[model samples]
Target: MSTTNQFQQAAHYARVIAAIARDRPVPPATLSSLHVIANQLDNAANFLDTDAPGPLSSLPIAATEALWLAELFAEDNPATRLPTDFTNYVLHRITGRPLPFPEPMFPLSDRLALQEVELTNRLQYLHDDTDMQVAHPDEWLRAVLSLWQKLLRLAEAVREDNSRSSHQ
Candidate 1:
């Protein structure tokens, strides 16, 4: 997978997670587990440039898979909720920036006001929703796979754009 593809995958996962979190009731313990998984994914992505195969190739998929699993387990365990703090932390770790409380619209301003609002709304929904479980884990996995493909493509585009700009 190219760097662009990786980024796109990462972005896609971020979006999915955000969507799942909305209008969902996540327990604190579950939130902690998700945070741990998110942290692992971040670590894996950081080591992608090393001599090894690098976790970047599979971290996003793993994270998404874990989330779906958690959702399954959530039926008997409503306590598996992800806290707002955990969600914010994961976003920060992945994007190298604080999670926007209210996600900003495209063409954002220097201030992250819009971003904050979006995040806040999502968080509220996640906290309030009663039915947050995944209906099909396989489908979720497939979606993540698609995101990974997109990430590779985006990474390539970024690299090419940079190369072209530098040569001019």
Candidate 2:
């Protein structure tokens, strides 16, 4: 696939994670963090679809503008207390641990390509997770933060490869 395709897919996965969380009834703090993540992903992805010029063209405008937001959210001691598990999860993932996600309950849909006719407008809400099912919302948010950085790096590598191949 082309770099653009990889970037697009990376963006989609970011959105997929956000959509998944949106379906759950997480606390406002967690939701706020998710919102920051989703917006950055969306902005970065959308910017890639444009013809912007610069040394940091690979990064989306949102990524540049809000570069430190995720770091702050993942901080051990922030103005607002972050869930310890969430902080741990983010730290571990940043240190190279894999992201944790349950097998999708349904097939992954390409929301960008889905036609209105194929879309289901039903409010697909998730029940409050049991102690075992989720354990905590912070873990989920932390996983998302990790995923964003991972995807960004993957997209950069893909774009670099594509540039090299094209120049040849």
Candidate 3:
């Protein structure tokens, strides 16, 4: 799909997430549609793994813009907490180590510390700049798209590395 179409879909999903964050009621159909879009975007990112440029490398700028928007919308709202299991899952997948329950897992290890720092900075920019008083749907959508793009790149890289190692 074209970048324009991808941005449009990302914007739509961002709107859904924003509504949910705001405690505004989201229709079941809209929620389902957002899920579908998420899955599609994930799949597209996966498919782009075979190519050199990779899908995500082409998306950082847009994703960065989107993240700025999401930060604004999420500022006044309670910080959206990730499930405990999510962190555990990431730790296991990245380190191949079994983490005991209640033990803190550092997501930014030596290898990925720089990347983590960059991502945090971007998020901070979004949080600090978002004007919750003003409904900036465009900004919110841009932020979400940026995040989705980053996820796509990470997924592709992991998949590619796994595939190469398995063949060796």
Clashes (backbone N, CA, C under 3 Å), per candidate, total 32, 0, 6
How well is each residue in 1-168 modelled by candidate 3, as lDDT tens digits? 455444444444444443433342346653444344334333333333322333543434434333333343233222232112221221222233342122222332344444545655564555445363125645544563354344434444444554664535
lDDT of 1 by residue, 10-83 (tens): 44444455444432344666565545444444433333223232466343445545444433443334343332
Give each model's whole-structure lDDT.
0.40, 0.39, 0.38
lDDT of 2 by residue, 16-61 (tens): 4445434544578766666665464455445444524344425455
TM-score attained by model 3: 0.29
Q: How far in Å is the alpha carbon of 55 misplaced in model 3?
A: 46
Best by lDDT: 1
Off by over 4 Å in 1: 1-25, 49-168
What's each prediction's TM-score?
0.24, 0.36, 0.29
- In model 3, the worst 10-residue window by lDDT is 82-91
> Between candidates 2 and 3, which one is better according to lDDT?
2
| Candidate 3 residue spans exceeding 4 A from truth | 1-35, 38-111, 132-135, 155-168
Candidate 3: C-alpha lDDT: 0.38
